[model samples]
Target: MKPVENAEGIQASLTLSYIQATVLKAKATLTVGILNGAPINIGIVGQADVVSDGKEGSAGLVHTDLLMQYDIQNDQFDAFLKATVKVIIAEAKVPIWLYFGANTPIPIGETAAEQKTRQSQNSNFDYYLYVGCPDGNGASRLGDAFSKVKVTIWKMDAGIVSGSLYGEAYFCIGSILPKFPPLPDEINKFLGYSTQSSNENSVINMINQGGSASGFMFGALVHGNINVDLAVIRAYAKATVGFDVALLHVTNPGSCQVGTSFGMNNWYAVGQVFAYFAMGVDLHIDVGLFSGNVTLAKLQVGAAIKAGLPNPTWMNGRIKIVGEALGGMVHVNKSMKFEIGEVCVPEMDPLASIKLIAEVGPGTDNVSVFAKPYVIFNLPMDNKPFKFNVMDKEGHETTRTFRFKVDHYTVKSEDNGYVGQGTKQFSADGYTMTLWSDEAFREKMKYTITIHCKAEELINNNWQKPAGKSEEEESIAFTTGIAPDTISERHVVISYPINGQNYFLKNEFKGKKSMVVVDQRNDKYFKLENDSNPIKKLTIIEADGGQVINTNFSVNGNDILFDLPGSLKNSTTYRMYFSIESSKTQEIKTTTELVDLEKTAGTGTVSMADVDFSTVSINTSVNILGASGSGNAIQSPTTTSASERGIRNKAKQEQSHRDAIDRFRKGETPVMTVINEGIENGTVDPTKIQDGTTAQGKEVAVYQPATGRIIYQMILEPVNLTPSPIKWLPLEVS
Candidate 1:
């Protein structure tokens, strides 16, 4: 071995040699900087030998050193030295040490401190080896180096044995350094096999199964002729195996590849079995039939049935008249007359063509005849009531007023009895009778029966007694009196039984009969009876003078009768007197009567005697006395006959009487003097005097003739008196 210089360029010489196959130890010292500097030491191990350069005198004894250098900066030097030392010592070879006697070596033990100091010094110097051997192959020489040193071999077989090397010779060295044993034979079993062959076989099996192991069970079976590529097969196997591998890693179960290895031949079959298990479900399919046997065909059948029915002849359908036997026995010829209310069917299609038949019994002769079948139909009749009239062959001898009650007829079908109740009332004008029924009844055959009413029989059956009276009568009676002014042509003579006398009186008088005079002053009037002296006397003086004037007058012996006049004044006083002479007694009978009468009785009279003086009466003795300024005298002698004294007494005492009367007189004058000259002879007539007089523009003042009050009496009547032989006196006046 040689010492090298430090970084300061200092150099020193040192020698290292091995003497034999024993340990040769040497030490070299050097100072290094810093108190804690790393120390390094190196050892060289070799053998001592003889060497020649090919001359006889040149053969000499020499030593070869197996050097180890420690340079901390050079990993190659450190590794080579470490490895060489391990190999030499495993062989029990020798080694030489240098640099062992330093202060650093004493603190860390001589061998460990020397190695640290050399490592520090060699940081700048490189280490090298020198061999001195006599053989070209280095093994024997390497063996001698080991024999001289006392070190044993750390590991054997570190170098190549034989043949060309491949792969990891450095790792072999590392193995020997650690003395690790060889790998087991079980681990190396696949050491030299090819992986491509295994992958190719897997691809071939996948292809034989047609790329789908479950295809056969799915009915997609392929023959062995189907092929697949090895790469695809391998990829598929890897995906499957890797998936299971991942499962195992997470689950930490047994190896996943165990099933693959044991079941490789049956893999396709297993998949097929699983597929079949999935496919074992039930399935179904459906189909429908299309034969023409539905309801539409049945409808066509019904139409065909309708088509085969019989056809009608007239009016869109056949007409079969039907009639029903009513009250009378009816005789119907089988061929001529048909029954009403019978189900004739009217020759409709597909139905029977039979006509409704009807018959009458043996007693049905010479009467109204009708007949009907059991079933009646409104369909053939169109819901109209059936009507038929039976007549003789000549059509002249019809039944006497036989009326069919067609309103009571009904159309019935089959055994539905009656179609409905017949309409009770006939149509207006007594023509047709209609029956109402439901639509169901109209759809069937119907029979109708009509009742007949005989006019004569109805008249007899419904006869009634007559009623009695109509009204009542009434009578009335009324009465009224006749007016006094009515003429005598004919009068309404009122006859009433009074005081047991059946006195009849003519209300008026005519011709040879005396005029009926109503002497109202005497209340005596004449009434005519049925005898020759029908004129009777009535005394009704209770009437005014105006009511008595112009009244009809008549006379009878004693029974005086007259109607009271209506124009009598309401309040009046009247006096009446009658004078009559009795021939046998030679005496005058005189009497007076008074009446306080109202004016309503137009012809009332008071009677002095019982005789009616309605015809004639005497008013005698008019006396004239005095005037206001003249001494005119109209006086009569007291000794003369009461009837004849009018003129005699007037001449005898004329002047003296004038003087005597004028002394007692006042106002007004008398223009005339007259007397009843026939009063003494009993033959005075009142009608001889003027009926009425009017004053001729002269006012003769006199006292009131009725009231004795001074008044102007217009002396309208001029009177003259003749003197007589019985001592006449001068007329007195004033």
Candidate 2:
């Protein structure tokens, strides 16, 4: 039959005899046509090894072998293949069309219309059209022919357009075709093409050689094509610039295998790339335009470009003392020093030498000294020590004992006394002193020190006794002096006199003293006497009889009942003494000695009776004549003498009364006695006077009263006088 024409100038035709012989591989059996085009042949290949027999001469055909053979499959493969084939055919130069008819027997020359009618009456008939092509090329040609055909076919029948061919023809074709090998040079280019390329094997091999070289080459190639489809060289240059700008250019690059697929494997490599170059390159390539599906080669190229950039380092230097002086007192007399060992700088070049300038004081007079500040070149290096000079304010260079040493790059300055004596002396009463060494030595050695003053002499050679006295006496004149001593050297001596003997006093008072006295007195007290008053009072006095009598004194009382005298006669030396004496009594008359009367009890005692008087009254008259001759014989009592005697008698009587009252108050009995011509007598009354009553309107002495109550009283008078009315009477009851 003649082929039909489609809009694209493609044709479609079918023969029943060709369908049976080619698809079924059977001898000519039946021929019939139910439509204007050939029927499609859908075959399922269940195994990868299955080969399609070209005898299936159907114009519209699809195979499902590839999908069925794979352990895992997805609809993507199916869809991709279907769309590819449909597009290829739709774009061809010829138009082709086919159809199926009922399974009715007909001769090979039968027309399409006649076949269709014959198959209409038989519902059980299944028909297929043979387009006379077994190979893909021939089938493709047939499809090209249909492209020009103009039959009104339903859009639903366009299986290729809808992607249903993915499960049938596309997958089947993939299963039959041989997989391409990888190529290193054209990997990225090959992947760029829509159709599979010949260099696949070479590309995969390059990916497997994961390293800087492969990463750079592959990544550059891939990155360029995807980037803007720019030239590979241009893309590489752009990426490198970006890496530099970003400061991410890696000095070293590395690569690794990330993953693999059915026909393609993925590789991953990373390295720092310059942000500037990468950015520029990416912009040129319009990388953002691409979807997320980028090849590993592109990423590796970007990373490698980043690896070739450089970063700069910053550094500075400085110096300072690590440790301070122990006491913080820098003295000139001792070794004043510090260490250069603590000097340090950061980010310094290991191979470079450090330069340090050390100044001790004013630049004008001071000297600058230093040793080569170079560290040793060793595998593991240490700080280097260099000795520098220390200058004084006056610019004088002082001597030092210790020095600094650097060995094996290890720097250290030891405590060398050479900087100075390391010892200082200060007058006990002087100001703080300072001493230091030359600046040169100081820079080399470091030291901390405690300052101390030398002890002053407690007794210097100039100490001497005052002159004029014997050595023994003069020795007492020596005194103590102040001095500071090293804790180990404290000692002192004191000299003074004791009694007549001279003694050297030793370290007695170590600290400050108010005064020192030396006394030679045997006794501390003495008696004072008037040569003319042998019977007078004696007095006690303090002795002023020593060379050391610098102290003062005074008398405690004027009355001298007894005397205690201090040593007298300073040069001769007399001892202290004491004296005692008594006063004389008056004469008494004879007959008044014996008398018995009621006695009164004293103030302090209890009384039993009223008046069994022991009160005495005795009168005795005697004539007073001049020693030469009696100037006048006494006749009657003259008022003059009488008055005198009365006064005297009154005084006497009052005294006696007071005495008696005192005795009674003290709980003692009052006694009345009269002694005459060498005879002493008194009267005692056992049961007598009453307790005394205090007299009113009578003057009584207001002396400090004794403890207890008054109990008795007594009265005495001369026999010649009349008794006055009793001003005070005693109670009679016991």
Candidate 3:
């Protein structure tokens, strides 16, 4: 075979026909023959026989073994073959025109319709890479290359005679090179193509590149901290490309597995497989899916009963429990049928099954009342309302106020409980809670109180229903005594200023001027039987002069106190007159002595015998007969006329003096009489009471009745007397 002179390619097409009667056989083979040397056989072609009928020809089979040594680099055959095909038929050489060319369309025996239909199917030429050359060359290996062959069959043009056949073959070198162990970049790209390939590096890269892996794909991130297997990734890269090249060569050989399953796309599964290989442990991550059931592991409550005072400071109580741990459990199951985002609200109805119950006391047990009682609880979770059902004697009350305190952290509601009123809401450690009744119990009344809660509805603590009963209860019964009002005045008596005692006027008393005082003792209450102030008014009198000393009543009704004048004498004897309710004006006599530091040192130990003010008189001898010559003179008369009128005037003055002294001794002082008369006439102020006339209101003239002449006119101004400190000298009543 050879090329035609000036022809662009080899012979356009090749066709052969034989008209034999019954059996026609054909065979073709190629041998390279040197110019003057023996022919060298490179390949073989087996004979093909045809059995034809007298009417038409029948197709036959021809088997051939052939190899064309070619250099793809130069687009020509090897030097020994000289880019030609020498075919010898039946040992008698037969000339065959075969050419390798630039552009040529091989032809085959098929109609235009058949060719169009096949073309419409979009078929591709089958390719083959012979591992070992048919001429006994070695097989291919890694990084090795020969040539790639593409064989295609097509029909000739109808104008060129239909049903005529031709064959086409394509060749390229090094394009079919075999390279094993894919590069890391190629492996990364393959992994990035699928979300399931969540190797730590692959997942992070994908995520950084704005790709996502959801569901079980991200489970590894939470389960094992995003563990990945580099070896598995390497193997996957190699196996994937190897299989693809094998399929290109039309063969499929079993390969190694990527861990256990081919679904390496599941990150959790991949992590599990890697985990097993690294540590021999299979991981089962929760993946934020729960079975939607919680069990009650433990339940404990406070005492069933408690006794309290009429107005107890605090009532011990509790509603505590424990349950199964619900860690990392999501609201939905793995199947993802439904999703609940809102938490269940706790029950807050006061009359509901879960509440604190305060039963009614005596006299109206049949009625129901809702009182706003105060309560405390040790609920360490949410700060939600804790309801209570209060059944008082009457049917009218508000919901209870509850304060939940946990670990010293107090969550007070809009209204505070009794626990907030100076008492502890929670225990020292903030676990126990003490409740208090809103109001003091009625006197001598029977009452009962109970606390209850439903464990299942405790959503604040994430508590759910258990298999059995979930309601917890505690109760207590007690009867109250007489009301606090009555008890306040019982067992109390006045214990100050004994009937007959002597007291000293201490210098300190001048500052306070509060002489009469009620005793500060539990048994010395100053309240009247009707709970009113016992003291109506107080009156103090100079015992020697029988003159009343006005006093002021204490403003505080709970105490019996009196404010005396600030002008009291040190060595005077005084009498306290108390006008008390349901009693007479009681009188207590007390003699006062000047404050003696030594004698007063022992408080409440001063005796009347210690100071003798009555027997020691600084009068007669000292005033009338002493050497001082300050003698007592006769009382002066009202007036005088001539020389002898002096004696008569003196006699009248003495008579006037005698009459005045007599009247004063008989409980009628001249000033007192005048003041009383003026008071009766509504002309003088009754509040002013003084012996010496100064100026209280309008001046009145004094008349010398013995001489029938008007004397001097004067006014009176009262003076505040300092009180003497009265020390109680309790003595035997007998």
Model 1: per-residue Cα lDDT over 584-671, one tens digit each: 2332122222322222222222232222222101111322332332323333233443223322322433443444344336323332
The lDDT, on a scale of 0 to 1, for candidate 1 is 0.23
Residue-pair clashes per candidate: 110, 119, 19
What lDDT is obtained when candidate 2 is compared to the true structure?
A: 0.21
RMSD of each: 81.0, 58.9, 51.6
**Candidate that scores best on lDDT:** 3
**After superposition, which runs of candidate 1 have C-alpha atoms over 4 Å from their true positions?**
1-6, 9-64, 70-734
Considering TM-score, where higher is better, how would the candidates rank from best to worst? Answer: 3, 1, 2
Query: Lowest-scoring 10 consecutive residues by lDDT in candidate 2?
Result: 71-80
lDDT of 1 at 593: 28
| CA lDDT scores, all candidates in order | 0.23, 0.21, 0.27
Look at candidate 2 and tell me the lDDT of residue 526: 17
User: lDDT at 418 for candidate 1?
Assistant: 56
Q: Write the per-residue lDDT of candidate 2 for residues 1-734, one digit (tens) a residue.
A: 11112101222332233343333222121222222133212212221111225444323222211111110100011100110112332321111212233321232234668655655543323222221211124332123311111112112233222211111011111111111111122222322322322121212212222111211211111121112333322222222111101111111111111232211222222222221112112222236665332221222221111121111111111111111122223212211122221111111111111111111111111111221111111111112222223222222222212111111111123443433322222223222222322122232133222211111111233322212111110000111111111000011011111111111111111121211111111011111111211122222222233321111122222111111122222212211112211122111111111122111222211111111111111111222122121223223223433224334433544454555465444544432221222111221132222222222111111111232223222322112212322223222221
